[model samples]
Target: MSPTTTFQDLQAAFPHWTIWRSSADRLWATRNQRLTDAQLSHGLSHTIDADDADQLVAQLRNQEKLATGLLPQ
Candidate 1:
């Protein structure tokens, strides 16, 4: 079995973000909408990349927390 989540699975799980894999095999995600200034100040970004889908998911979850003020900026 594949160790990483499929692109379709990630997209389905995170409808707010666009997910894809790079030519170099990195997993990448970008928000569908721009982040607010407050979110930017909190270190949120419009795009994120990871070595694998699992890592990308973790980063996305952290981004969600930051965007929602669940975690300290």
Candidate 2:
């Protein structure tokens, strides 16, 4: 299992996005519901052994870059 990313770390890394901790004690990041599928698919919304929030955010940013041709896949 990977290390857990604190809500504070994710908030600091992504202040523009909405960061929250669920009653289940999971940290979550939401950007107008855009990353919902990807977050869930990657288990970012869950508390158990979730991928590092910073890494997850980086992945999302990289995906955006790739989609926009700003970065090569």
Candidate 3:
């Protein structure tokens, strides 16, 4: 069975894929709309870029700040 996946896991898995921290529990997959299959594949190998990763982290932080909320997204 696939191991239980967390956003962190997904971030690690797809270095090349543009992952948005959709929720603390889930990952959002995005690719530049113009990217072709080959390009997407190439990108997916890298994982989230610094800016995106930071953004995701920030989102998570914000959620954390909203003490009433605990889950991601």
The TM-score leader among the candidates is: 1
Lowest lDDT 10-residue stretch of candidate 3: 42-51
Q: lDDT tens string, model 1, 1-73?
A: 1555577888898888998878998888988887778778888899999997778888998888777753333
Best by lDDT: 1
User: How would you encode candidate 3's per-residue C-alpha lDDT over 1-73 as one tens digit per residue?
Assistant: 1356455665575343356544454444543234445544443222333334445555434323442332222
| Candidate 1 Cα RMSD (Å) | 3.8
Between prediction 2 and prediction 3, the one with superior TM-score is: 2
Question: Looking at candidate 1, what is the lDDT of residue 18?
Answer: 93
Count of backbone collisions in candidate 3: 11
The estimated TM-scores of all candidates read 0.82, 0.36, 0.29
Pairs of residues at least 3 apart in sequence or in different chains that clash in candidate 2: none
* lDDT of candidates 1 onward, in order: 0.80, 0.48, 0.42
Error of 1 at 10 (Å): 0.5
Q: Roughly what TM-score does model 3 have, to 2 decimal places?
A: 0.29
